[model samples]
Target chain A: MTRYKAVIQYDGSDFLGYQIQATGRTVQEEIQKALTKMHKGQKTVVNASGRTDTGVHAKGQVIHWDSPFSIPVEGYYRGLETLTPDDIAIVSVEEVAADFHARYDVSGKEYRYFVKRSPQHDPFSRHYALRYPFDLDESLMNQAARILEGEHDFTSFCSARTDRESKVRNLYAIKIMPTEDGWIFSFSGSGFLYNMVRILVGALLYVGQKKLTPAEIKVALDKKDRTALVSRTAPPQALYLWEVFYEKDNKK
Target chain B: MTRYKAVIQYDGSDFLGYQIQATGRTVQEEIQKALTKMHKGQKTVVNASGRTDTGVHAKGQVIHWDSPFSIPVEGYYRGLETLTPDDIAIVSVEEVAADFHARYDVSGKEYRYFVKRSPQHDPFSRHYALRYPFDLDESLMNQAARILEGEHDFTSFCSARTDRESKVRNLYAIKIMPTEDGWIFSFSGSGFLYNMVRILVGALLYVGQKKLTPAEIKVALDKKDRTALVSRTAPPQALYLWEVFYEKDNKK
Candidate 1:
C-alpha cells in the first residue's frame, strides 16, 4: 500500500466536524467519498492529525491515506482538487512510507480565534468572526494568556466531555495581536482536549472584561475541576486550525 | 418634517438592486419596510445617491429621508438596527435640513471592484469578490484605465438598456491597486451611467488578458456604440459603492 500526505484547507461553516457522523455532513466523510469515487468505487479511509469541532475552520490541516493505485504525488492533488467542493482546497500532496500515521505522528498544532469589535456588524465577515461590541482590554488579556503558557493540568479549561485520562498538556505559546478592526488570539500546544482552546479564550475574555483576574486563572488550574473555571466557551465559528507540525524525517 | 441623513452598508447578495422591484427583494424596499415598521404603519420614503444593481454590495451608501416624528438620530439608528435583517446596517443617522436631497446634492461617488486571480475560490469571500483564474497583466490594465479618466461620453460603456439621455460624465480618477491576493479597481466620478463600472472593468480585464489592446478601448469609446465594445460585464457581487461626497455647507 502507498501512503500520501495532504495539506488541506476548508471553510467549516457547513460541516458537522472533521469526523464522520450519521446525521450531518463532515469534512472526513466528504473526502472519503471523493476518494472512493476517484478509486473506481473502491473505498478509502483517511486519518487526520486532529478532529476539529463543528463550525471550526482550517487552513493547514494534515491528513494521510493509503491508496491502491501508485499514482505520482502531484496526481493525487489534482484528483482531490477535481473531486472536492469549492470550499475545500488541497494545497499539497506527497508520497510517504506506510508508517506515516497522521494522528500518531502529529507533534503540535496551532489555532487562532478572531473577534470582531466593530459597533456595526459586517455582513460579509460575520460568519468568520465573533462579534463583540464591547471594548476589550487586550493588555489584560495578554497578561492572562501568559499564565496559560507552559505545562499544566488543563482540566479547568477542557470540556467536560473530554475522555482523556490525563489533563496535562504543554501550551507552547499564547499570543494576542491587534487587527485592523478586531483582535486575533493564537495558541500553540502539544495537544488540546475537547473545547480546551475555546474555554481558554473564554477565560481570557473574562479577564479582558475585568470580570476575572489573572490570578484567578491559576486558581482554576489548581482546582482541576471544570466548574472552577468560567462556564462560557467561545463559539466554534471563530476558531480555526492554523497548522500542524511533525517531527523531522517522518514517514509521511 | 425632519430630514435625516443615514450612512448605510449592506451585503447585496439577496437583493434585486437598490431600487424597489416587483420580483426580488431590494435594499430600498427592505429599509423602507423597516422604517414603516418603526413608525407604526406610516410609510417612509428614502432617496439614495444612485441605484446599485442586483448582487452589488455597499460600504458607505448615503441616503436621506423625511419623517413626521422628531426621533433622536440614535433612535433612528437603533430602530433600524433592530428592524433591518443581518445583511444590512445603518451605520449612522444625523439630522439634516429639509431641503437636502440624496440624489441631487451629491458631488461625487466612489466605487470599487474586487477581482480574485487565484485558481482556488475563497468560499467565505465568494459573495464579495469576483474570481478570475486566468493570468492577467495588471500593468497593461492600468495603462488602459488612464484613457478612461476625464469627462467623456461613455455610450459604449453604458448598458444598452439604460434610459438616461446624457451619456457624458466626469471620471475624476480610475486607479488599479494590487492587493495581497488580488486586484482592486477604484473609480471616482461625478456620475456613472447604468452598468458603466462593470463594463469598464470588463474592458480592462480584456485588455489585461491581451485579447484587446489599450488602443482598442479608445477606439471603442470614440465609436459611441455599445456593440463596438466587448459586451462582457463584471459580476455585480464584486462591486461596492464605497463612498459619496457632498458639499460641506449643503443643508442636507
Candidate 2:
C-alpha cells in the first residue's frame, strides 16, 4: 500500500462539519465515499490534520490515506475530482512516507477569520463573512490579540467539549489586517484546541467594541476558565483553516 | 402616495429569476412579500428595471413602488432591511417623481460576465464564476468584442424566445478586461434583448477559442439568425446586472 498526503480546499457553507457524524453532509464522508468508489468496494479510512466545525471553510486542509491500487498521483487527483462534489477540491497529492500521519506529524497550524464592518449586510458576501453592524476599533483589537499570543494555557478560549487532557498551547502569532470592507484575523500556532481560534477572535472583537479591555483579556487568560471570558464564540462561517504546517525536511 | 425608487442587490443562486413566476422562489416574490408584510395585508406591486433569468445576480437593480404611508426614505430602507432575506439587500431608497417608471424610462444598462480561465475549478467561487477549463487568448477575444460593438441587428445573439417587436438595439461598448484568474466581459448598451449579453459572451469565447474568427462574428451579425451562431448561451450564474442607468436630470 502506498501512503499519500493530499491538500484540500472546500467551501464549507453546505457541510455539517469536516468529520463524519450521525446525519447531515460532511467533508470526511464525501472524501471517504469517493476513495471507496476508486478502490472498488474496499473501505478506505483517511486521516486529516483536524476537523472543522459546520460552516467553517478550509483553504489548505491536509489529509493522508493508504491506497491499495498503484495509481499515479495525478490520476488519483482526477478520480477524486470527478467523484467528489463541486465544493470539495483536491489541491495536490504526493506519495508520503509510510510512517507519516496527518494529525500527529503536524508541526503548526494557521487560521483566519473574517468580519465585515459595515452597518448593512452585503448580499454577495453574506455567506463568507460575519456581518458586524457596529463600529470596531482596530487598534484595540490588535492590542488584545497581542496580549493573548504566546505559550500559555488556553482553557479560557477553548471549547468546553474539548476532550484533550492538555489545554496548554503555544500560540505563535496573531495579526489583524484590514481588508476592503472588513478585517481578517490571522492566527498561527503550534496547535489549537476545539473552537480555540473562534473564541480568541470573539474575545478580540469584544475589545474592539469596547466591551472588554486588553487588560481584561489578560485576566481571563490567567484565570484559565472557559466561563471567565464573557465574549460569545465567533460564528463558523467566517472561520477558515488557512494552512497546516508539517516538518519541511520530512516532506520536501 | 409617494413613489419610491430603490436600488436593490441580490445573490441569485437561490432565486428562480427576477420576475414573479408561477412556481419557484424569485427575487420579485421575495421583495413583494416583504412589501406586503410591511403594508399590513395591502399588496404592494413593484416594477423592476428589468428581469434576469435564474442564477443571474444583480448589483444595482432599480425598482419603483408607491407607498400609501408617509414614511421617511430611511424608514423604508430600514423596513426592507428587517423584512428581506439576507441574500437580498436594499442598497438605497428615495422618493422619485410620480412620472418615473422603472421599466419604461430606462436609458441604458450595463452587464458583466465572469469567466474563470483556470483549468481547475475553485470551490469558493463555484456559485459566482463560470469555470472554463481551457486557456483563452485575451487579445483575440477583445478583437472580436470590438467587431460586435456599435449599432446593429443583434438578433443572432438574442434568445429566440424573446417577444420584442424590434431586435435592433445599440450596443455602445463591449470591453473584455482580464481579471486576476479570469476575464470580466462588461457590456454597456442602450438596451438588450433576452439572453443577448450571455449569447454575446458565448460568441466571444468561441472567438477566443479559435472556433470562430472575428470576421465570422460579423457575418453572424449580418445573418441576424439565432441559429447562425453555433456557440451556446453562457449560463446565468456568471452574469450580473451591473447597473441600470437613468437620465441624470430626473434623479441624482
Candidate 3:
C-alpha cells in the first residue's frame, strides 16, 4: 500500500463544509466520490489536516489517502483532474511514507479574514469579503489583536459545537494588513477550534468600533465564557484557510 | 422633464449585451425594466454612450434618461438601486442639462482588455479575463500597439457588420501594462468601430507570439480590408468599457 499526499485548493462557496454530512455537498465527499470512481467499486477514504465551515475558502489544504491500486502519481492526478468538481482542484501530489498521516502530522495552520469597509454594498466582491459599512479604528483593532498573541484557553473564542477536551492553544502570530482592496486579518496558530478564528475576528471588530476595550478580551479568555465576547462570530465567507504545515521535510 | 445621467458598473457575465434584443436579457432591458417599475408602467427610454458586445464588462458606463416624474436625484437613485438587477449597479447619478445626450455628446472612450497567460484555467477569474497559455513578448506587442496609435481609417479592424459611413477614428493612446495577476491593454481613442478593440487586441497577440511582424500592423491599416488581419478577434468577456469622456464641461 502506498500513501499519497495532495495539496488542494477550493472555492467552498457551494460546499456545506470540509467534512461529509448526511445531506448537502462537501469537499471530502467530492474527493471520496472521485476516488471511489477511480477504484471501480472499492471504497476510498481520505484524511484531511482540518475542517472549514461552509462558504470558507482554502488555497493550501493538505490531505492523504492510501491507494488500493499502485498506479503512477500522474495517473492518479489525471483521474482526479477529470472527475473532481470545477470549484475543487488538486494542485500537486506526492508519495509519502506508509506511516505518514495528514491530520496527525500537521504542526500548524494559517488563516486570513478579509474585510472591506465601504458605505455602499460592493455586489461584485460580496461573496469573497465581508463589507462593513462603518468606520473602524485600526489602532484599537491592532491593540485588541495583540492580546491574542500567546497561549491561552480559547474557550470564549470557540463555538459551543467543539467537543475537544483541551481548549488550550498557542497563537504564534496575528496582525492586520491593509490591502489595495481592503483589510486582511492574518492568524497563525498551532490549532484552531470550531469557528475560533471567526469569533476572534468578531471581537476585534467590536474593539475597532470602540464598543469594547482591549482589556475585555483578557477577561473573556480568563472567564472561559463564550457569551463574554462583545460581538457575534464573523461570517464564514470572509474566512480562508491559507496554509497547513506538517512535520518532516515539507517537500511536495 | 429632468435629464438624469447615471454612471454604472456591471459584471456582464450573464448579459447578452448592452443593447435590447428581440429575445435574451440585455443591460438596457434591465435598466428600462427598472425604470418602468419606478414609473408605474410608464415607458422609459435610456440612451447609452455606446453598445458593448455580449459578456463585455464596464467599470464606468454612462447613460441618460428623461424622468417621467420630477423627482429628486436621490429618489431616482434609490428607486433604480432597489429595482435594478444584482449584476448591474449605478455608481453615481446627476441631473444634466436639457440638451445633453449620452451618445451624441461623447468625445472619447477608454477601453481595457485583460489577458492572463497561464497553462491552467483560473476558474475564479475565468469569467472576467481571457486565458492564453502562450508566452507573449510584451515588447513586440507594444511595438505593434504603437503603430496604431494615431488617426487612421480602421476599416480592417472594424467588424463587417458595422454600417458607419466613415471608418476614420483617432486613437490618442494605446499601451500595455502588466498587472500583479495578468496584463492589461489600454486603448483611449476618440471613437471606435464595432469589434474594433477586440480585433486590435487579436492582432497584437499574434505580434507578441512572433507569428506576425509588428510592421505588418501598419500594412493592415493601409490596406483597409477586413480580411487582411492575421488573428481572430479576442473574446468579449475580457473587454471592459473603462471610461467615457464627453465634450465641453463633460456633463449630462
Q: What is candidate 1's lDDT per residue for B1-252, written digit by digit as tens?
A: 898999999989888889998878899998999999888899999899889988999999999988999889989999998988888988889988888888998999999999988876566677789998888897888888888999999999999999888999999999898898888999999999999999999999999899999899999999999999964888899999999998766554
TM-score values for chain B across all models: 0.96, 0.97, 0.97
lDDT for B193 in candidate 1 is 93
Candidate 3 chain B: 10-residue stretch with minimal lDDT: B118-127
Ranking by DockQ: 2, 1, 3
DockQ of every candidate: 0.47, 0.83, 0.31
DockQ of 3: 0.31
List candidate 3 segments past 4 Å from native.
Answer: A14-26, A29-44, A74-86, A163-166, A248-252, B20-26, B40-43, B117-121, B160-166, B248-252
Clashing pairs in 3: none
Candidate 2 runs further than 4 Å off: A248-252, B248-252
How accurately is candidate 2 docked according to DockQ? 0.83
lDDT of 3: 0.88
Candidate 3: tens digits of C-alpha lDDT, residues B1-252: 889999988878789999999999999999999998888899999999999989999999999998868888898778888898877878888999888899998999999999997776554566688888888899999888889999999999999899999999999999899887668999999999999999999999999889888888889989999998978999998999999998766454
Recovered fraction of real interface contacts per model: 0.44, 0.91, 0.19
Off by over 4 Å in 1: A23-25, B14-16, B20-25, B116-120, B131-139, B248-252
- TM-score sort, best first: 2, 1, 3
Consecutive 10-residue window with the lowest summed lDDT within model 1 chain B = B118-127
Give each model a TM-score: 0.91, 0.96, 0.88
Q: What is the C-alpha lDDT of each candidate?
A: 0.89, 0.92, 0.88
